[model samples]
Target: MAQLSDDCFAFGGPMMSVDDAVGLIAARVSAVQERESISLHEADGRILANDIAAPLPLPPFTNSAVDGYAVRGSDLPLQAEAVFPVTGRVQAGGSAQAPLQAGHAMRIFTGAPMPVGADTVFMQEDVRLDGNGRVVVPAGLRPGANVRPAGEDVAAGHPALKAGQRLRPQDVALLAAFGLPHVDVRRRIRVAVFSTGNELVSPGDRRGDAQLFDSNRFMLGALLARLGCEVSDLGIIGDDRAALAGSLEQVGRSHDLILTSGGVSTGEEDHVKAAVERAGTLVLWRMAIKPGRPVAMGIIGGTPLVGLPGNPVASFVTFVHVVRPTVLALSGAAQEPLLPMPLRAAFTYKKKIARREYVRVNLRQAPDGVLEATKFPREGAGLLSSLVDTDGLVELGEEVTRVELGQTVGFLSYASLM
Candidate 1:
């Protein structure tokens, strides 16, 4: 396996700035080129690796938007109670009858192809049926009503989806509308997860020797899986240099990405960062963002590696803000916008201009359809309950030193949490 220069990770007054770290990572990274084709039913949550165009128009025909009577718009007499014979019938997915001659109407249903020469539809509710099976039309009916023209929903050969687009349920439905049974998507990366600390014990195991439960492993693992990565849970690695290096070597060989928690901080027992530097580059990134100030990024062998803080909340925040973008980039996704919907603040807060801050907050709709924000009671980096209690994050920019009451701020949707 490949490794970095022995002294590449040597200390130099903290590693890289947040902006600089992201730049370095992005500079060294590119999406994998491999593609995986799957059926539409299985493509949800997958990222498109190639451009997808409509094989055909969504409707594929001029159809009715409602169940009504189809007729020649001018045939309906301009006067009250104009009547016409029901020439034929059209149902959804059914062929049209013989073209309507002038002064004739046809019974139609929603999604049915509009018969030729039928320029308009008078809704059943708008017309009264006469004893002769003909229908009376209201005055002032327009030329075309309730007609869904062919290619109206989706144009033939239009770009139905773009490469790097993440497929959602609606996207799958769009594919089905094009008669596509399969989709082409980027191959999901296999990420191997592990943690290193003799002081850590797995869940269900009794703790001893200044030990704590290994929560970050499971948390990060689940997050990676939800992002559509195939994850290999390597559990925990004890703090022996050989064992740590061995585990890293194994993961680097088998996985496209290797993620580890803890051991990046400087302490006698914290050798994760040292081992990474010995085996590969482990650049520490002291971000401008708070509660997740300590972030590490570098390449391990041919695989990318991220080292997050041991604090659960710090790990989560760092993963979302810093690591999530990198993962999405490597997975060939169109980058998501960072700006959230601007919201009015319900509380006041202050911060240093040099450092960015992410405040966990809950949102409630006000009487006038505006969103009000409330901060969590506690704001510690290790308090997992803060994440559980809050709806989403309020990002305070690096320049703004203080925010006053009721000032408008950007609020990210909690619906974004996954």
Candidate 2:
């Protein structure tokens, strides 16, 4: 993690906008330069450390695209039906015995290298075999039909995949095609996740009447795992400032980042803010956004720390919008855009204050085959069921005062983020 300036959290003022906060984090955070070599089987979702260029053309040679007969285009008869001698046969992985002569066709299978002097191919279905062992050709066939030219898909020395690319299945297949067994990728980010609250208890444990199960740690751990980070669950820490500060200091030495839910807000029990400030520095606090507003970003003992809201919905939303990008930046991966799709609003909304809002909405197709976003009846940051019942969030800008029915709104899908 890079050492952010002590005044980075000053932010010129307080209550930064969502865009400004994201931009500031992206601009200041630097990628961890450490890299390692891993096999293709273990490279999925890993970021590339360097660009990979094609060692040779994709096909490596001109070949037939279909099971057809290879022949010189000029040798085709102008009339409807004409007989041509079958001089030879070629299959994939086999070399051409001789150059194709005029008025002669050679049997060729799909993916077979084109025979010497052959400029065109006619599918077998279009040509018939005569009783005299000759192929009957049809007219109007164009040159170079059904033939895959050399380097058609990719040229030699061209970049196949660039650095910072997150490898997917198709990307792995491309590397395999070039016979590359291992790839150079950045090391997975090391993260420590814990929740702060005396009233919090882990799942599967008997909870007291005043205690609630700790859900944020599990959710944050899963989200971090999805982003290809190595997560260590530190469980729940009480509101004791000394214990919290000690935990932060201990984890900072081993992990690249520390994530905590709760304890950042200005509440009596919120010790995270004070503990982090005592241990290190608080860079930013309280973003101007709904569902997730009291977000704390800073560094502790040289490790980056992000404190999220205690509410499950707020925690999930803040992790997606802020922590996801920060994790990617720390891992040396290219930042992915979170652009939302346009959808018609099915309900009306009014907001008197100027703040970015993300409303949970369920999408349904209208009778006219258009997608409409319907707002959930309940609107509370603690209601986790709302997220389960909705497909995604409908983003309302800061200046927008009201949303009328049937108005176009931007929607961010849960699938895109998760």
Candidate 3:
């Protein structure tokens, strides 16, 4: 495990903006240098450690793009369709029997290598075979028609996938096409997640009158898993400082990062910040973002820690905005920019504060073919149903005070984050 510098989060300021917080994190944190070579079967969702270059051109040979007749373009009659004797036949995975002679045609199947001296292909549908083993080719057929040139898909020695790319199904198929059995990828990140509150209980546990089910840990665990991390659930911890400190110290030495929900805000019951300070160091305390503001970032026993708010929506948003990027950075993946699509606002919005805000919105395509975003009926951070009912979020900048109806707003889909 690598420890960030002491001043990594020592920004002397009040609540930090989302951009500044993300920039600071990206600058201070370094990728884990460890890498491993794994089989392509297990490479999906793994980040590439190095660029993968094409060993050979994708096709490696000129072939027919469809079932057609290979012939010399200049040999075709200028007036109308002319009959030419079928000289040879070629099928996929087999070479041409011989060079195509002038005024002759060769029957070729899709993916079959083009015969020597043949520069054009006519689809079988465009030609007819006579009873005497002769094929008629249309005069209007263009040169190189239905022919797949060599290296059409990918050129030799070109990069097929770059470093820090997370392999998807198509990427694996590409590697398989190149006959690469294994790939070098970054090792999975280890993360420990826990929730801090005396009133919280696990789903399977019997609950008291005042106890609520601990939902943040499960949600965080699933989110981390989706990010391709190995998650260790530390379960729910009470507000006892000694127990919290002990758990933090124990997991800090084992995991690459620590993530906890609750006990981060300035309240009497909040003890996570104090326990983390006692165990190691608290780097960042707060962020100037709505739905989630009291996010605490620190280091414990050299392991990075992120403390999210207790509200379900706030925790989800904060994890997507703050923790997700940090996890990717630490795992050696490239920082992916969040590009939101512009959509028309269906309702008015007003926020007097100068803080960045993310509103849950459901998108609908209006009858005029324009997409519009409508805010959810409720706006409480504790309302988990808002996230379930909405398509994504509408991001408002820090200076924006009001949003007029029909105004274009930035819309980020939840699919993008996933």
Best by TM-score: 3
RMSD of each: 2.5, 1.6, 1.2
Q: Name the runs in model 2 displaced over 4 angstroms.
A: none
* Candidate 1 C-alpha lDDT tens digits along 1-418: 2233434434456534455555544555577778988998789889998898888886898888888899987776676778888879989879675899888889999988888888789888888888898888888777787888888888989988999998999999988887789888989978888888888999999889688999999999989878888889898898887788767766887777788888877778888877877777676667767877776665677677788888888888788777777778778887675667788888889898767688888998888888888888777888988888888888887788887878998887656756
Best by lDDT: 3
Query: 2 or 3: which has the higher TM-score?
Result: 3
Clashes of 1: 0
Tens-digit lDDT string for candidate 2 (368-391)? 999999999999999989988999
For model 1, the stretches where C-alpha displacement exceeds 4 angstroms are: 1-20, 366-369
Pairs with steric clashes in candidate 3? none
How many residue pairs clash (N, CA or C atoms closer than 3 angstroms) in each of the candidate models, in the order given? Answer: 0, 1, 0
| Candidate 1 vs candidate 3, TM-score winner | 3
lDDT of each: 0.80, 0.89, 0.90
Superposed Cα deviation of residue 372, candidate 2 (Å):
2.0
